[model samples]
Target: MARPAAKARVPKHLVALAVVAILGLVLVADYLWASSSASSSAVWSSRLNLHTGPAGSTPPVAKKIKEDKKSVGSTGINATFADLPAPELKWEEMAEAPVARLDGAAIQIKNLLYVFAGYGTINHVHSHVDIYNFSDNTWGGRFDMPEDMAHSHLGMVTDGRFIYVVTGQYGPQCRGPTTRNFVLDTETKEWRGMPPLPVPRYAPATQLWRGRLHVMGGSKEDRHEPALEHWSLAVKDGKALEKEWRSEKPIPRGGPHRACVVANDKLLVIGGQEGDFMAKPGSPIFKCVRRSEVVYSNVYMLDDGTTWKELPPMPKPDSHIEFAWVNVNNSLVIAGGTTDKHPITKKMVLVGEVFRFNLGTLEWSVIGRLPFRIKTTLVGYWDGWLYFTSGQRDKGPKDPSPKKVKWVALGTVCHCHRCVVCLFF
Candidate 1:
């Protein structure tokens, strides 16, 4: 009789509570599933829209992400100061560039470093000149470049007050360079036309040597064949004294993207490539077409501005280092650039090692390395620190992934206020 006693009736309120708990669990599970799917499908923009200025300053406008539709490559990895080849050196981060760009030019005038025209994207070019004040470690005013100025592949140099910008790709990617050249007066912030190049070149070796603007050895208009052509213009006070560029002795090795500098009153051309990336002839958009290129370690120096003497070569072949050098203790300190191609992948490999070519010894040595492998880095030196910014960073060794970066990296080369010991190379 006791076993047969009716099963205890479950409490109605308890049954109702159990049903509600089950419903809640199902809803939460559904929400999590939907969120997971959405996150997996989202795509990230390539360019970062950062607020750039003195640290802690409020942004004038709301931040926005710029998605490069044409940037359809792998999102590469990042590198830091810890990755530098020199263990004794330390890197300090500085103000972000006013605009992220590559293949631009940077020149120091007094305590200010002026960064001008370059490619914002393959199809987007920037015409703004941003000034960074090293005196205060702040990004100061920005001005507009000449509207018609070429944006990328520019050959730029400064003579105390005037900055000369020479021939380069005028518009979007792979477009032919303009014959037009320009000069900007830092004091006036005004740009005026200079004598155009006789043959439009891409990233020619340009430097102010002995009161003449010497330009030599850049890719021809087609952006394929190297031009051995050499030309010079007498320039003074932000103006070209001559109507046209005078012809000079041609370079022995013709190429683009070379670092041209004046060291010990000698005009030196170092590290460049024979060919460059061209545009696909028939593509609707100006799509970049990679062609065969030869990276060389050849070092040519013009001792008397006429005869170019062959000097000791770089430790490795390098290119795209047009502005990646600074004079440190009478030595030429060169930074990251594109070097030889990967044997297996056949893609261009990037160089991270910092090289020093001693003018006194005529020797080459590796002093340090960049945070990462990069090309087209604009460089400057102030107060015993080597500062570089704005370039295309590669993924890693043998990985040629194109990673857009806006990092302002500074490495201490000598005794630092931070009390770091100098590791002389």
Candidate 2:
């Protein structure tokens, strides 16, 4: 009887309230613990500064990037090649060109390298054509282009069998442009006439895509008039000698000395000088004329042939005028051209930097610097090597003397698992 009396009845509502209060207290404690733990974890992470490398690779606890002393160009942009993955490039001296020339075009067909018309040592344009045989490593089989077809700044392209030479200047001294177009059969070594361009131009970029020849921006008849028009020509039959040129949509902006190449099935127009070069007034030297030209860092891409869309600008704002560009493994590799922004003085100098743009990532990085600054050089990609023909080195205004070059620099592209290694001497 005494034990039963001790059990006093509790209210149901009070019991329910007690249970709710306990649950609320438990949640509050959990929230506070979580907040404090998260804050401490973040603080520790910041202080630790952990870095993770590629899977299965050990990452350094700390990294110190060394500054590169070499300057990029007159642009004053400096970059270090230490952090960048090395490109697959090996450079060596090949056989010297049979002749030294500038402002010309070169194309590789099979094992033969065709060097077209260009200005020689005396600054006189020559119609000389020289073929270099890779099999024998010799330059021979010289041919004279027709008097009419002999021109510089011509847009030349090859379809693996025939070389198509398009619009160009008639002479070396900034003469009027020529509309004449010709095709040379590599098999027969015979030249034949093709349909002339709708608009005559010089230094236009020509490339073969989808069995059609695409001719892009260049200067008009007058060196001052930039050709904004674009045209394409197709040979109905592979063996046909005659073809019709059709005009496509024009480029939004025109530029002379633009470099064009097809990479990843996209037609890319690289940097070029926009404005016309004019003589500077009150200059002491004859060639001391100041250029009104604006160097472009813009890049445009044409995928449909009817529309051109601008892509990311170059890393630097220097013009690629008279530069050499090649498509290596779907990446755009540009090298050797003057900034061309300033006059021929200490400020005006050739760009010794080499830039490579990855089409997949749309990123550009300075790969390496040229052994010597060069401009208006001929660059050809054959097998796994990039061949740089003769080019002039600018000694600046004090000297204003053109340096002679005869050796052909061969850059052999070495393929690594995830990176390219470019070795140059």
Candidate 3:
């Protein structure tokens, strides 16, 4: 065989060089992976802190995140909050609102909370905005809304600078809703009109998602039938790009007072009722006739922006929680609201449990209990605290008295899905 075709002499130094090159590549890959993991952990920690505070405002506790990880597992302390029991919330009373009202809209712009128009009393409805300063802990700067704006049951959403107010009951009591829509420039404090809703709705679920203003699922003009119609309008700079609203897929169920939220880039409508009180015509056109209501715990999600998918239901039936929600870490915490009628009394019962919905796990849990039962509670999260104000109190459904008292949730809103070593080290 010609002595294996004169086999080439293998150089020992060359073989050693090849081995070193392979080892070096392996080491490099390991280092890259470690660095990548560290970056991911840091980014996640920062996001967690962001949700607990206002935009661009970092709390002092965030600086200790690194040190906290080091002490997480040293004393057998649990690092993963995924399995941690829900913390009992203790509420601290804060400054009362400028006025007592229900069915209003509230949005947070940095440290300021703007409370919009709502039902004041039987024939009275507020047509002004009350600004609450979270930093100074005071309610100041009261301004009037648009002259023709709907007072109660108005669907409202804020794009940080502009507050968009949509279809709502024009007057107090069982009055019909107006299709008129308006947008408020928080900077100039000027109100401009937007395209009217194709169909008038009462307390329609309104949100800004993916550069479109979405409004859906509320009582129809009858103020009793659920409006399944879904509509969206391309909007920019507080102005509607399209001439009219474009209709989308109908909701699985149509109802008013549902909690509509955009979390994790998904649209969620949770816990509402099909039927509502109707206006009885008489000497007093504003008289509201009580109607049978069917409270539900059904939770629906829209992820593809086209189809509606049902997700896990709430722990119990809830409604009038349209604004009683705050974004926590990977979850949504809702405050007090009305629930289904009591079994024994056969009367409407207000919700007291503060429920949490985990977006990651798609589950619901009673995270804590509110200090008292209330409905139409306006919620806001700031500086590691959950705040709620201006809602109808625990009195019977017949009582329309609204409260101005505000409360701050005192407890850690922590839910971790990763361990200390896995997330940090």
| Inter-residue clash pairs, candidate 3 | none
lDDT of 1 by residue, 355-420 (tens): 888788899876655544667777776554556777776644324534433221221111111110
Best by TM-score: 1
Which lDDT value does model 3 have at 37? 38
After TM-score superposition, the amount by which residue 401's alpha carbon in candidate 1 deviates from its true location, in angstroms, is: 4.5
Q: Once superposed on the true structure, which residue ranges of model 2 sit more than 4 Å away at CA?
A: 1-91, 236-244, 276-291, 318-323, 343-347, 396-425
Compose the digit string of candidate 2's lDDT tens values, residues 218-308. Answer: 7766465667888888763233333667787888778777778788788888887765543234433212123456667788898987778
Better of 1 and 3 by lDDT: 1
CA deviation > 4 Å runs, candidate 1: 1-88, 397-401, 404-425
Clashing pairs in model 1? Answer: none
- TM-score against truth, every candidate: 0.75, 0.68, 0.74
**In lDDT terms, which candidate is top?**
1
How many Å off is the CA of 199 in candidate 2?
Answer: 2.7
Q: If both were scored by TM-score, which would come out higher, candidate 2 or candidate 3?
A: 3
- Which lDDT values do the candidates have, in the order given? 0.71, 0.60, 0.71
